[model samples]
Target: MRHYFSDIFLRKAVIALSGLLMLAGGAAAREFTVNTISDEKGNARTPVISDTGLVAWQAYSLHDGDTPVHQRVDVLSAPPNTRRSDIIIWQDGKTNNLTATDTRLTGRCEQPVVGGNAVAFLAWFKNETDLGMPFTLSIPDKTDEMKQMESDYPTLFDPPKPPPVSTVEAEAGEAAPPPEPETPEAAATNGLNENLQRQMWRDSGQAADIVYYNTARGQLERLTSGNRHYCSPVVSDAGVAFQCARGWPYGYEMVAWPASATNLVQLTTNYYYVLHPDLHGNELVFQGWDGNDYEIFRYRFDTGQMEQITNNSFDDTAPVVWDGRIAWVGYPTITAEIFYWADGALRKISERTEDNTAPSIWEGQVVWQAYDDTDMEIYYFNGRRTIKLTSNTWDDLAPQIRDGLITWMSYVDNWDSEIMAFDLSDNIAVQLTNNEFEDSYPQTAGGKIVWQTIGAEGSFIQMAVPAAAP
Candidate 1:
């Protein structure tokens, strides 16, 4: 009886030792180095990395009473008058202020995207109408009649439209005569009111223009001029593509700077709005207005053809392109779902009832965040099957995949985000960062990850590389 009991105890000991060894091996596999790539004093945000280890971000100096606000797009704030945001580039262990030498660029540069030897961004200039002087109305004291008129028509101060021509006038061969000109006092009053209203809609008296840093030429180049609002720039080896506002009520059109082009080209003129353009090689994809909802529009520079990849009443948005494959979030029903286009056919990759959004695709792999009843979880779709990478209560958002390694910012403990990564080959998940600060917007390229970290000092750019990373 004693011999049999010893045999059973020894077998249990071996199994427990084997389990301990496996856990230690998994921990060792996740060990990596995290580095701060941007200057702490520069207050960097929106860091982007290229496949060649090139990094670019928007940096600005914050003064006293300056409240820093981080955003997925460009920073939206009334920045200090003494300083403006600029683009910073890091390459080969050295950093360069990309726009410091360009005196002509008197705007806040943001949204830097790097591809190959180019870094494209948006530079917002202060509107010419915005003088340093305080805005005031010098209208004389209102009489009782004037007060009554204002009370009767709340829009009395609005710029009035000209009266429509009568039917009799249209039937006549003579052209309809213009309305009498306004008095000087009336014109000044109307102009003041219009300017005040327009100023309210502007970005704190600023309008953006697309600009790029040509590292090959060692110079900064402005792609679009005339202070139009051009934003959401995506860079590629071919060139840059972005959306430009068509003025007035603010409709957007797709614009591109083709490879080796001296001038800008407007890709879409459908008068409808376009958003979130992704450029890869010679193919461009974006979500365009399609009467009822947004639909995917694919453009080919090689053939100069624009094809509507999706035609549905449901809204399709946030489309991303890799090689010839396209992935986007589609609202086939009331809930958002993941859809992809490949091999000249469309496929629905996700069937969740909850909202699934922010899909990133590479090769045949797709990764996105889906609301999994408990919290936002990261979901992965390989070429063959689908799998849930994370199942914790914490919210995992903005999953990006590159070279079989997926990275995202996972909100932890007290709503503070930390960067996390999962390797598809090894089927191992690892936390890339753990600190008191918030690390968000983890972008992956060539096995490297870059993100924006909000710290006590200010927001800065951080990069993480695995021990086995290429």
Candidate 2:
């Protein structure tokens, strides 16, 4: 039987962090600090960290107090929409609210992916403006008999109506006075204003499109526009690759925005439900439906060609690309397994019967989580041997590897999770966080790791630097 061990459980049971720790056998002792990058007002989540120490994430802020009250009847009973999402970036001890600075971005902006100094994300209006047309609730006109009934039974038909309440007032438990009837001129002006507002929302540069911060020009640029949804953008040396909905029958197609270029290229016209695209260098990889099952597909930006890497009955999805190699999850039977494609050859690296998914590839190494009949465990492939990096009762998920350093999130319970890391060269595993808060979704890059922590106050982005071995 293979001996299994958990660093998190062992560290918590044995070692108590007192600023530093001394290791046995004269091994190097590690010391590091966890720094909070986001403020408490907005609950930050899903942070993306680049090699350049630039961190980007999505955060939700409280809605403004003075919200406009439309005269429409539906607006009176609509549920409160009191939170708005914005993309935030932190770099070099400075924080910038990217969505707040841009006047045109007037809705929920999220799903930020940072590469180098640039950040790419998706932004769309959260209001009726995203409908792309003026939305009007059709209220049936009351018949003459209804009007007579109201006139005859004034007490029952016309009870005192409560005043309309704004979101702030409702939260504060305060009642607001009803507004007076609008004049004909005021109604006309309001209608014109509504149309202008809709137009501005629709024409808001890159609404429902791929928006990215241009490092060269120091401004946000819209990669694609029009009324369509783009999903799962991945950044690389070539540029960004994402799946875009091309309407019905067409489904979704893969699109790419070349680095430092204004022109957009549609890499796939099949539009067969492409999802979770990953880009590295000039090669873009993703899983596309092929009528039978999902298969792995790769597109080369330099050659303008598409290649189908896998063609089995099983569904192969969530491909992550690095250099020219790709790693993903494939179901050989009823259980999922880790699969890899490199040097024009495909191989199943995982030998376990349990489910293995969310594979991350860097250089030639791959890391992912696998089920071991009890809970999830982290597994790794160091280009030769398959190694189990984590073995614990808790579920270890979202393993990311970069330059021989592997990071993952281990959950002690449904609401308690922590970040753990393993160094390949030293063959040492370390628990990076030990606190009451839930730390998860660890992403490693350029020897630096970033993750989000959820606490009672709010979720925040945190960065940790692992000390080098002495």
Best of the candidates, TM-score? 1
Span of ten consecutive residues with least summed lDDT in model 2: 1-10
Off by over 4 Å in 2: 1-26, 63-82, 125-207, 412-415, 467-470
Who wins the lDDT comparison? 1
lDDT of 2 by residue, 217-275 (tens): 67776666545667778776568777777543346777787787666677766535778
What is the number of backbone collisions in each predicted candidate, taken in the order shown?
A: 0, 0
TM per prediction:
0.76, 0.73
In model 1, the clashing pairs are none
Q: Can you tell me which runs of candidate 1 are displaced by over 4 Å?
A: 1-30, 62-81, 125-206, 468-470
lDDT of each: 0.72, 0.71
